[model samples]
Target chain A: MARTRLTPEREGELYAAVLDLLREVGYDALTMDAVAARTRSSKATLYRQWGSKPALVVTALRHNKPVSLAEIDTGSLRGDFHAVLQRTDDCQMEKDSALMRGLSHAVHESPELHQALRELLIEPEMTGLDELLRRAVDRGELRPDNPALKYIPHMMIGAIAARQLVEDRAVDQAFLIDYVDSVVLPALGV
Target chain B: MARTRLTPEREGELYAAVLDLLREVGYDALTMDAVAARTRSSKATLYRQWGSKPALVVTALRHNKPVSLAEIDTGSLRGDFHAVLQRTDDCQMEKDSALMRGLSHAVHESPELHQALRELLIEPEMTGLDELLRRAVDRGELRPDNPALKYIPHMMIGAIAARQLVEDRAVDQAFLIDYVDSVVLPALGV
Candidate 1:
């Protein structure tokens, strides 16, 4: 493979192209050729930069995620959660959800993709959420020994994904707030 | 099109073939030709009976689901949930999860399949769970006006699905019980 040096902007364009194709055709149907054609880049360049479709898709998803959760301190756990949930730009959320839905099947079948998703996308966000929750524990807003703590990410993120999958509904801020107030907060004994 | 009278046993065989193929190849890669070859049935017969791949896959999934939630009364809400969660035959659960994972991507892209899944598979289970929760409310185990009542199905089912998707873990009886005790019960203020 010929090595190609891609600028940050060029890399972003490739990522966008991959995500667009992912949403349009899904993981199984998407091809490196299509991504290269869409971005007007050679397939060799894409392969050289990302190595494979799963690697490219994972990198794309990671690129699209919020860079930092450090700015999400709202002093209270509920406020912080609501802030984080609402932090996704509305336009981006639609695309991200579509990309996520598109990747769901492939992720299960491919261990490499699944591991990359956990390591690159989910783990980082989870680490951020965990940090926020720890701050709440420090503030006496929650019990340190609460078993619910282990499942908070599952509950909140899962609820959103489940609502979308089962009900075909978009999870708006109102729904997130209600979820936090009624389900998450109560589970935390707040 | 050749008119074929499929016996009950023949229909079961067809459903099994579809699900098995779905697990092995996934929804995108699964083909009517493959199903026909697997079941030793004509492609014309499959199309005549199920109309399309999505239709056949959805029918197969619906056929595999537990037929009745009527027998799930365990007197207590927690017991009922545990019973329902554990209701799937263990061997079947593995196959079903694989099938579900395989269908995840297609479910989002195909509205007809999505609607069929919600109506045939999800709604029925949600109805059963809702009925159980109502019984709990009547027994004064939970408040009728509690906001968490609206999200019980999402919480329990979502937590299980989320665990599988994110953590790649089997949601066994012990995990469900702990989830109920820690997350669901606390969320419901029990």
Candidate 2:
């Protein structure tokens, strides 16, 4: 095996730098050199750590996102979805949300990046959401095989992310409320 | 004013070449030289017409999208959404869809391109969807102020586009049916 380098702390610094650069330059213009310069790390350090631009960008995004979900016990599926989507709204509108923008550009260009992103940023959060929905089904809130559950997360975030990238608009709390009340609650067959 | 040099047909040919280059190479690797070669036009000719890469790419996207909506009287809100979404699915999954990919990448790097794309591609489609929804409300099939209606078209198409870009997946007839049953009808309070 070639060697695994970078302590978790060092990785955190690198990701913070990447986040700053993403906000300043957006994804396509973000350069590894700028990341090294910002983090006071050598170019060799980044190459040794991440191996490629896509890898580095992916790591940075994964780092920025809340990969694990809070335990959902709001006592109802509708309550849980509203809570989850509320957190989603917060993440999308974070103070410096270059991670979302970077992932949008990266996914569009590279399938590898897209897959990694789907696994790291999208899948984990949704796995938690899926668990919550499964609990709802068990509780008879939805059909046992309600297919809409499969695509709901994709639909909710997809709309917001696509709007952000295509319209250059920022998501906010009010929009999330409207989205959940108007889109998700109904789509779940609630 | 300088005399208009390239004929309309020649301009169309060059724009078509830009789209081809975008599909083949993506925005990062695409260049005006490649476009000139692809179209069999001189570099000078391209510059004289488009002036820059963003302008050229934006024009190509604008020229390629079929913006005119089909005047269909499906006589129901859900029916109309299904019809329109199916039409959009066909356009989104076309083989030469690098235009979509390139535009997605271009928007990441250039806010100007993002805004232009919204104006040229997203806005036209969204406007048609909005008008369709408005008519449905007038028919009392949907509540006039249902917030979900505002986001439904975006949600449906966003799901398709995001899936296509991220998962190498495209929207199909079955996906459309699921969307109507789960999202459209519920949002209309049916």
Candidate 3:
């Protein structure tokens, strides 16, 4: 079958459709046929573009994530952390949580999906975070070899995810601030 | 239909079958019919005993967990944490990780499963951890009103889970010790 070229706008539509289907039916039950039907795109085009269900889903997740890490600088480590936390709060709406929950099992089951999620979706954010932390180290706000540096992403993001999972509570701005002040800053010896 | 009374040993067998099936097929794909076929138990008996697939899976996870908090204390908070970490290492074999990954999406989708997981598998462990922390506070090893106390579970377990999900690394005894010493202890000002 000849491939139909999708414009950037059309690509975004397909991603939105995939994410919507993910929220409704979840990863396992979601099918390529459903995505094609929802988006009014050809199944062959989807396969041609993304190869498989895991590939399409991974690409959709990556595409949906706000990958701009350019505006995260805030001078001090605490300020930078707070800024990032605020950004996280802004992006992590209920629908995003549902998508994350839906993909959680599939990510673990498929190495390709896990790699794509980590590298494409999660790594950009982590890189941005690390850059902020590195600036703090350079500015003498933190020590060069703080062991807690290794755990910042895991600590902050994990706390947010775990809170939602274990307690069903949203990690709002207030909670993020509290987490930074109580758990993160203290652990870093700030 | 007459209900079959399963002995404690038979009940254990059924739980094992459920967990095994969950590992093989995941929460959404697993069926009561499959469970009945695997265990050679009547579908009516399974329904009578567990009510639903979520209930059965939750019960199976709870049953497999080493639920005794009685053996967690080891005098000092550090010692107690180490003991608990060791037990966690022993219990969190490859199979357990697989089950956890399998159930991650389902837990979010079903409130019943989420509650059952927290109550049965997670809460018992947390209660034990909190008791140890409380004892430490009473002994003046930690401040009575430290805010970081609320986040200990999230930090430790979250780090372990995050490492597996992102880095594909096992949360071994060494890593747990490092986490407790560097992250947990320092945050507690111990």
Write candidate 1's Cα lDDT for B62-164 as tens digits.
7887645656787888788777768676577767766777676677668888887787678877787778888988898989898888887668766767777
Q: Which ten residues in a row have the lowest lDDT in candidate 1 chain B?
A: B1-10
Q: Write the per-residue lDDT of candidate 1 for residues A4-90, one digit (tens) a residue.
A: 577788878778778878877788888888987899988887788778877788989888766567668989997887787787766
Residue lDDT tens for model 2, B37-126: 788878787777766777678777777655444365588877876665565555565643545545555576777776666776677767
Task: Encode model 3's per-residue lDDT on B16-124: one tens digit a residue.
Answer: 9888888888888899999999999888888888777777788888788664655666778888877766766534665776777777667767798888777766787
Worst 10 residues of 1 chain A by lDDT: A1-10
lDDT of 2 at A51: 80
lDDT, model 3, position B147: 90
2 or 3, greater by lDDT: 3
Q: Where does model 3 exceed 4 Å of error?
A: A1-14, A28-59, A88-92, B1-11, B29-56, B88-92
Q: Global lDDT of each model?
A: 0.79, 0.68, 0.77
Measured against the true two-chain complex, the DockQ scores of the candidates, in the order shown, are 0.57, 0.41, 0.55
Compare the candidates by DockQ and give the number of the best one.
1
Root-mean-square deviation of candidate 3? 3.9
Instruction: Supply the TM-score for candidate 3.
Output: 0.84
Error of 1 at B84 (Å): 0.9
lDDT of 1 at B43: 91
- How far off is residue A59 in model 1, in Å? 2.5
